[model samples]
Target chain A: MRCWERPLIEIIRLSVNGDSHEIGVPSHYTLLETLRYVLGLTGSKQGCDKGDCGACTVLLDGLPTLSCILPVQEAIGRQVTTIEGLADPDGPHALQDALDLTGGAQCGFCTPGILMSAAALLNVNSSPTRQEIREALSGNLCRCTGYTKIYEAVELAARALREQRPPAEVLRS
Target chain B: MLRLHPYEYHRPRELEAALELLKEHAGDVMPIAGGTDLVPNMKHRLFAPGHLVALKGLPELHGIVERQGEIVLGAAESLSSLADHHLVRSHLPSLARAAGAIAHPMIRNQATLGGNICLDTRCTYYNQTFFWREALGFCLKKDGDVCHVVRGGTRCVAAHSADTPPILMALGAKVDTASPEGVRSVELDEFFIADGIWNTQRKPDEIVTRLRVPLPSPGLRTSYQKLRERRSVDFPLLSLALAVGLDGDDRVESIALVVAALGAKPRRIGGLETLAKGERLHDELIEEIARQAYRQSNPLDNIIVDIEWRRAMVPVFVRRAIREALARP
Candidate 1:
């Protein structure tokens, strides 16, 4: 295709996790689309498409953001980490493992978003109670199973990290 | 899912530049604050502005400060910042309580106090996505001809949806707006218009720059109470914010009581002052005040939850808000 074939909307190159893209996006394309489509990081699901459903959740500069509605241009100078970035390619995030062990995930459309939200929550609060977990995960929804397992998973992850509290081993090495 | 249609985006550092843009562009431009309300509404296709004048990068519009015995909160200060600011927590505790109760933690981090103050008066018939409205036919607030919420209605019946306005009104806040007409301060009570189509007293070109609040006396007490379906991210079904103080012998010195989600703008049931004069804060007095609140309020069935439940609870919310105000010793 020729350069003139597509509308030349200005874009700031975005680096999500380790990958980078010089994609041409319509001014309205959100960070969620850039991560899921241009970058092929499927871990960031499109749940609500509005900010309400945390299924599109990711960390913008280490704080959880609903990527679905976050303008891509707003991500111009920010760091974005998706759920895929949370774990080593070899395995799942300890939170994810804890989720499985605790049966935290049921219908998994929300799993990726919930995992990222929990990862951010767990990083900030090493000793979150069920109330904190509930509040933190309010943006994300799990309809099939109630919130019991999810709350338990957060507690387990907190304990795991507290005992050893290793710096998250997933992204760099 | 709500999507932002393509629009021109301009970031101007100065307030005058922003107001100039609004003037030149007029109705075509929408001012972007925290996007707490505007962004979501935009996604829902409730609005389709050709330009978005973003205020986030503006240096002049981002602080919470106290000066000359008054607290001036920047129009763009995030709710989280206001909720956490010590001056706000001290002088305007009811306002602080209301701000903290809005939406949720993340929203509070991003929703601006001014953004909530200027929300389009919402009607249940009016707040839905474009597609949802298409299915049901549109109402008076946006695209359609008839007011779905009020049959045979000549004007829109959208409820005042902002959570903070009632609180700010009760705190005796004033808005400072800058337009090509120059700057002016309007008492928060006057800032709202009862007519639903144009709910705000502000001209389209004016930008709310700062809100000023007088310092609270040590004896002044305040409280805020809201009824919403969920603890997070839902607009208020019925809300009340009240501030009260007593004279030398604990009689009602002055009172500021405001209600939201019921009408076009927060209405002051200042009638409570007459009811409270010379009377000690008592269950019977509170009951009268609550009854007066229900009597004064006229809620319509255009939003989520029942209109009857909302009307019935007006007194409850009023009593609770007044009780909270009394509890603020």
Candidate 2:
């Protein structure tokens, strides 16, 4: 099929991490590109630049999605949560701290995506079994850590969240 | 960074407007629900549609409703939502399992049922970056002249990778489509064509609106089994879907056995009804059914696994699926 000529760029208005932003981008631009390039939220890595890798994973309307394949126009008016959004001004999110304490992030390339996936899981089920954690993070491939530490980290985070304790405090005790 | 070629993207709030846009653009336009498949293909330059009619925002294609003894699934329903839907899990667990089994959780969260059903057939020779495909001199499915899977063959042999169609077909599902002319419903079995290049009968101007699955009768049991390389995101090397109904006497009254990912379209094994009719669930009968499935399957060397191995696994999967379906209460 031939290309249809249209406006060179379109303005997209969406809420990312509770902040609303209006950005001009190509209609075909993926959410990953808009997040990393335009908005400067580079936590979501562009691993495969395809749906195969979940390194560009982020939460769209509270569900984990592969931002690399998601068109930016589709995210219009939707709530997008990236790894950077996961942290508070006070400190890192419990999951991030748990990953750090558990050595879940060796290379740290896949950690952001894994954190989002795990965070989505915890949103629904605060206490997920190891199998559930494995299934939830199956999309995020961590080549360096071998997933054992990552699974432990998610479990640790879940426990921290359930007990209403900071991950750092839990790890210390 | 792999990027999509510049194209006009149109997101219509209403389904009617979307259909009109499709009709106006015709051959130049492609309706994209989830870009999980199409965006990657666009990156590979396999398809460069001038206009993409985004179906994501249309509220019409976004709900799972139960009406008149049928489950109506909106075409744009995300795979993750469908898998987790209570009705799907309680009634059609096989479909939920199939949807959950697709790609990964992240992809499932974005990919939709309509997109998965209309997923492009895949081959080792066809799915590649533009540079890689150019270096190898594209195959029949793309810009090439010959079929690489079968040397000297005239037709493309890419395998269908969707996990839902076979199960949907076996469960007697129908797909609804809309165009400028009107809206029509097609049985899932009749929707798929047995060619890799143009696999579905869906017209360019038509958009799949919804999938209607007739509620299976009591005593009707179903199962879906897929064999893929990995436990995560890999597409099925071979898949078997079984739907069987038992009579009051516990004899098989109706049976549908479908094998997918072995060819361009999911093939329903012929003579299954006759062979399984009035037959009791026994070792010999199951073995005979599995053998029939093995005989009916035609696997090519286009996908990842060994051709012969895939062919041989058909019976094994069929047997397992049959047992699983029969075992389910």
Per-prediction TM-score: 0.91, 0.97
Alpha-carbon interface RMSD of model 2? 2.2
How far is each candidate from the true structure, as Cα RMSD in Å? 4.0, 1.5
| Model 1, span B1-329: residue lDDT tens | 45577776667878878988988788688788767577768877887777778787677888888899899999899887898899898778777878888776656766787787788777767667788888888877778888877788988778887777887887788999888899999998998988888798888777888899988877677878888888877778989888887777877878777878888888888566677766788888888888888888888887867889988988888777777666656
Output the lDDT of residue B102, model 1. 76
Candidate 1 CA-lDDT value: 0.78
Compare the candidates by lDDT and give the number of the best one: 2
Interface RMSD of each: 5.1, 2.2
Tens-digit per-residue lDDT, B168-284, candidate 2:
999999999888889999999999998999799988888888999999899899999999888999999998899999988889999998899988999999998888899888999
lDDT at A150, model 2: 93
- Docking outcome class, model 1: acceptable
TM-score, structure 2 vs. true = 0.97
